[model samples]
Target: MTNSIIKSLSLPAPEEIEVAIRGQRALATYLSTRLETQKIAIQDADNNTHQIELPTSALTLLMTILGELAAGNAVQIVPVHAELTTQEAANILNVSRPHLVKLLEDGALPFHKTGRHRRVLFADLMKFKDQRDTNSQKAMQELSDLSQEIGLY
Candidate 1:
């Protein structure tokens, strides 16, 4: 996606932001206490209205994304099968190109070559990121436990 589109998605209109923040909490409550089936209504400028049913899982994701945008955090939605260039993959991972290359070589992340350039599947990148995050959380928890046992925390 272009930077402009990303920037726009990262922010909501002033009124929209307020609504989104409220919606985030409201959606969570509904998901927790009410039914999982939900429908959303859209109204066009001409006053034509349409309604669509959304799975609870999808609604949860939408609520979370909206909340993030309301808080001025950037969010990007990439199709699972999308192919990304080495640099694009690096940017997504917040790492340098060379580091991403190393991960690819180490089999920590998988990639395929198109001519001289390497391309990573969006799904594979996300898998690697999820595992890395889980590992980091585990390590932090271990450290915290050790510190507490040693009377350092």
Candidate 2:
């Protein structure tokens, strides 16, 4: 049980670690240290271990997650018109602000400048991504059909 607990805590990704803990009663029970401001400890069914404590790092992450939840994210679940400044648009595209501006100037994304700073609508961004996906799928299908037609598959 100690070996498994150690293995799970040492997992590379926090999500995978949390999943391992939740899936294994023993793993959850092996947690040994946490700060006072950390989350309340939860016990597994048929409790056999009570001396264990959740790690402070894990608890801090959980607290941040709780904060995010409380900050209201359900409203952002659906794509809608979101007026975004240049910096925000850059973040959405995973590009530098200047590069995003260049794309905007090249008519890549439907955007407008408000007194020098540019703004984008979230709906337009979603449509752009959708079109890209559609085109990519169509191209892939064409390639697959060609390969089969040529007896390559």
Candidate 3:
């Protein structure tokens, strides 16, 4: 998602964020504690009402996503099977277009040729990004441990 879109999704004020956070937390707590309250009520702007039931796992995931948004974090929901252009994928990864192309060429990321252009699947991109993030975290942790052992931390 573009920064402008993300900015637009951001909470208008800190107080709104706080209120949203609390509301999500409260709903989560209530639903978890009250087993009888299986379905949630959804009200539309037109005053229409809908109710849907969710599994506990799904409810937990919803709560987490809402919590992140309520904390003023920009969240983008993309379909797993979505295909993205090279520039869009690079933007998501916060990398240069050339670097992304290099990765695709080097077999670091999988892509398919659409005519003359490369198209990357959202799922594959996410898998690669998750692996890279895990590796970076591991390296950082090792460095911190080494520093601690040497009395530098």
Candidates ranked, most accurate by lDDT first: 3, 1, 2
As for TM-score, the candidate ahead, 1 or 2, is 1
Model 2 lDDT per residue over 1-153, tens place: 111111222213555445444544443454335444333445579774445455576655554443444443211232365577767667666779998888789998898766776778778877877887899999999999999999999
lDDT of 1: 0.79
lDDT of 1 by residue, 1-153 (tens): 222212344355688778877888877765642557788777999999999888877887888787787796667777788888878888878999999999999988888887887888889988999999999999999999999999998
Q: Return the candidate ranking by TM-score, descending.
A: 3, 1, 2
TM-score of each: 0.72, 0.44, 0.73
Best by lDDT: 3
Cα-based lDDT at residue 73, candidate 2 = 27
Collision count for each candidate, in order:
0, 1, 0
- Assess candidate 2 and give its lDDT: 0.60
The sequence of per-residue lDDT tens digits that candidate 3 reaches over residues 1-153 is 212221245443677678768878887776674453367888999989999887766676677777877978766667778788888889889999999999999999999997898988889999999999999999999999999999997
